[model samples]
Target chain A: MRVLGIDPGLTRCGVGVVEGSIGRPLSLVDVGVVRTSTELHVAHRLRELEVGLEEWLDRTRPDAVAVERVFSRSAVSTVMGTAQASGVAMLVAARRGLPVALHTPSEVKAAVTGNGRADKAQVGAMVARLLRLDAVPKPADAADSLALAICHVWRGGASDRIAAALEKQVAARTRGVRP
Target chain B: MRVLGIDPGLTRCGVGVVEGSIGRPLSLVDVGVVRTSTELHVAHRLRELEVGLEEWLDRTRPDAVAVERVFSRSAVSTVMGTAQASGVAMLVAARRGLPVALHTPSEVKAAVTGNGRADKAQVGAMVARLLRLDAVPKPADAADSLALAICHVWRGGASDRIAAALEKQVAARTRGVRP
Candidate 1:
């Protein structure tokens, strides 16, 4: 399944799309950053972000959207903006009826690099190697977004199956059907 | 000017509209809450909020939107959701070309209750009195949202004028015009 990953930030949001599923080689579809001026009003900045994200969504239609979950323990001054950016990403995906997945930074690191505590360099190197790129993507946010997409492809498929199975089981029970 | 105030929350968002200027008696145009199920996916909840806020914006057609500024120092688990909800509100306003103002909790309280540190009960009481309502608005979020609108009308007008004056001064300076 093709997946779009978003590393959300107010001033610089990273977006990347990858096509693949678990146990398959991944191919890069696109990668870019959406930026808004810090000098603009917050409302205007959000509008810019929404427009940028919508453009990406339209140009690169993906099967699912994966966003980095914003942690509350981050820098106090930036947490609000990050969360707001993340929300915009999710809203765009949902408006399109696309399934959305939120993966923590550590989860993405572990999925890509086999180390939950991997540093940026390690994650970037792993993403490069996995995608068979000549070099890592520039602007760490872009690389991180690709890593998040890779992680979602590797992990989200299994989670979706599990959820589907549970849903089927619940439906069977509701209908008094034997498993 | 008619102002719409939004107290952003994931499960329970407070929305209110008031009509008046800085010195005029404020009138309650509307007051209500938008609720999303906690059991729903985060993306779905955000979509619900966006739809609800959009409906309110379309119905009220306010001149400006006032959102309560989210602080990271609030409850750890709720701050992210609040900020996300606030982002949706701001986006709707910006999309409509309506001015948006963010008022901190203390500023709202001060404007309504004459004390920045006033408690919820005090703010609620003041909101009722200021709007000439028979009773304090049920649900503290609703009252807080009205207070935010009131605060923006009283404070944001002056701030907006100052900002406009500064812009004109900078433009004159660029043209080498004497003040």
Candidate 2:
């Protein structure tokens, strides 16, 4: 499955696309950051973000979108901007009928690395190694987005399997062939 | 000038329009709430809010828009939703080139009533009195929205006059005239 991951921020929003499924090698489709100028009004900044995300969605057309869940307790000053950017990201993806998944920063770290408390360098290194990239993506936000996409793909596999299993059981029950 | 004021919320977004200038009697154009189902995903809820705000802007065609400023420190559980909703409200207004104003809850109270620490009932009563309405609008959100619009009109008048004076000074300087 092709998944798009976003690390939402008002000043700099990171976006990346990863294509892979379980038991297969993951490949990086594309990655970049959407930056908005501080000089612009907050409303205009949000408008620019919306336009940028729409372009990304149109280009990649991912099966699912993964956004970093913003916690209000993290930073009092930036939490509102982060949350607003995330809301735009989710809205853009859902408008296209794509499944959107939210992963916490720790969750992304845990999925990409072995530990949830992994540092930024460790997470970047793991992402580079997993995607077979020559170097870690620049501007921590880019690497973080990739990690979120990878996490979604990996976790989404497990959930899809469970759903398929449930469907099979339901189908069998409808046929009076419960096993 | 006409202003549309919004009390941003996920479950019950308050919206109201007021038409009048400072030193003149204010009239209530409309007041209502836009609600989204809790069962819907966050993305869809945001989308619904965007649609609702767009409709309000289209129908009312207010000269300016006012949205309650959301503080991250307020109500940790619902702050994110408030920020997201406020973001959408601003975007809708800015996209149409309408000036957007943000008023804090305290500022709204101070503008409508004499004190910043006034309770909801006091603010509601003042809103009713200021707009010459028969009764306070139903739902605290509705009343709060009118209060915000009224606040914007009262405070926006001061800023607008200052802006006008600045423009006049610039024009006079260009004509080499001293005042």
Candidate 3:
């Protein structure tokens, strides 16, 4: 499946698309960032983000979207901006009927680097190695986004199957049936 | 001027529009809540909010938009949701070229109740009295949204003028001229 990963931020949102599945070699489809100027009005900055995100979605048309989950441990202002940007990404994906997955930073790191506590440099190096690139993608956000996409491809399908199984079990229980 | 006030929330977003200005009796143009089921997917919930906000903006065509600024003191999940909803409100306003103002809860309370520390009951009572409503709007979110609109009408113009003056001063200094 094709997955588009978003590392959301107000000033700069990272985006990357990867095509592959489990036990298969992944190919990079695209990687870039969407930026809004801090000098602009908050509303205008959001509008710019919306337009940029829409453009990316229309151009890539990925089957699934992966977004980094916002954590509350960050400073309030930073968290707010990141959450807002994440909201935009999710909204665009939902409007297009694309399945959206949210992975924590640690989850992405573990998926890509086999270490939940991997630092940024380690994650970047691992992503480059996994994608068989000459070097890690420039600008950490871009690498982070690519890592998110890789994480989804590696883990999202299994999670979806588990959820479906649980759902089926619930339905069967409601019907007084055993599988 | 018409002002649309938004009390941003993930599950229930309160929206209200008021028409008039300071020194004039304000009229309630509309008040309602946009709700999303908690069981819905996160992306779907955000899409519902986007649609609801777009509908309100198109219907009211308000001259300006006012949103309650989210604070970090709240639970991380709550803060994230509120900030996301606020982003949608601001983006809708920006798309239509409407100026957007963010007022803190304390600011709204102070404007309506003359006390920054005023409780919700006091703010609701003051909003009812100011709007000449038969009763306080149902749901504290709805009432708080109306109060936000009232606050903007009463204070936003002066603040806008102040911002404009500051901009002019900066421009003059850059040009090496005095007003």
Candidate 4:
């Protein structure tokens, strides 16, 4: 399946598109950023975002989309900007009839590196290694976007197994409760 | 000067427009929320945000806009949504050609309750007393938005004084260093 991943930011949105299966090396279709300027007024930024995202969507029509969710800790201003960028991403995917999945940083890392607490560097290395790229993706956001896509692809492979396991656990709980 | 405060959220955005000098409430225009459904698709939510924000802007027409910053401790999904909502608010102000001011939670509470770490209830009581409202603004978001507006109005009075004070300090430091 073809999947697109986005690392949404107010100023720079990192995006990646890849084709592959679970735990498999993904063939890179495209990677880049949707950029807006701080110099522009607020309205101008949103317009720029809309126009840019539209262009990207038209150019790279992936089957599915994966977006990083925000978990802001500080800098309210920064959070506001990141949120706007992410909103644009969601709108683009949802409008285009694409199923968008959200991944937390930890989840993305765990899917790629087999560890939830893996840092950005480790995630980047694993992403490059998995894709068999000679070098790692530059600008952590780009790597992050790639990782997110790979995680989705990898997770999709075990969908049946995962679902069955979850069902079995639920059945066990039901039996335990009733008895 | 008039200041409008906003608590931007995906489902509900709380807005309050107030006109006042430093340390006083001159006039209160309105305080309320724009609500949306979480289950609704992204496009629908975006439309709701646009219409609601536009109405708030038309009704208030304040001199400035102030928004509470979004920060996250967990769940990336939430941060993304909140950020999107905040973006809508910022875009509206920017489109209207109004400058936006941001205040941190601590800053808002410090201005209203004389304590930076005050809770929502404490701030709401003070806001009720200050705005002379019969009851606390319904929904914590509304109260928070109103409190933020009051904060800017109260502290904005000293803006000029603070600016002058900083200027004097800079001049003194320059003179001392040069001598």
Q: DockQ (Cα-based) per candidate?
A: 0.31, 0.21, 0.30, 0.16
Candidate 4 residue runs with Cα over 4 Å from true position: A9-12, A19-26, A34-55, A70-88, A91-98, A110-134, A154-179, B10-12, B20-25, B38-51, B71-88, B95-97, B113-122, B129-132, B154-179
Give the Å shift of residue B146 in candidate 4: 1.7
lDDT by residue (B1-179, candidate 3, tens digit) is 99899999989899999998879898999999999758666776777777778778878988888899987667655778888888888877766656778999999999989999999999999998988999999899999999999999998996555534443433332233110
Each candidate's interface RMSD, rounded to one decimal? 12.9, 15.0, 13.5, 18.4
Model 1: runs farther than 4 Å from truth?
A158-179, B159-179
Q: What docking grade does candidate 1 earn?
A: acceptable
Show pairs that collide, candidate 3.
none
Q: What lDDT does candidate 2 reach at residue A58?
A: 80
Candidate 1 structure quality by residue, lDDT tens digits, A1-179: 98899999988999999999778899999998999878677776777788888888888999889999998877668888899999989877766667788999999999999999999999999999999999999889999999999999988886555534443433332233110
Kindly report, for each predicted structure in the order presented, the TM-score of its chain A compared with the true chain A: 0.88, 0.87, 0.87, 0.82
Better of 2 and 3 by DockQ: 3
- CA lDDT, every prediction? 0.83, 0.81, 0.82, 0.72
lDDT of 1 at A73: 77
Worst 10 residues of 3 chain B by lDDT: B170-179
Candidate 3, B138: how far from true, in Å? 1.3
TM-score of chain B of 3: 0.87
Q: How accurate is candidate 4 locally (lDDT)?
A: 0.72
Candidate closer to the true structure by DockQ (higher is better), 2 or 4: 2
True contacts kept of 1: 0.61
TM-score of chain B of each: 0.88, 0.87, 0.87, 0.82
lDDT of 4 by residue, A1-179 (tens): 88888998867888888899754557988777777767654444654665666676778878777888765665455665776777767655654445667788888999989999998889999988887788888788888999988888876544434433433433332232210
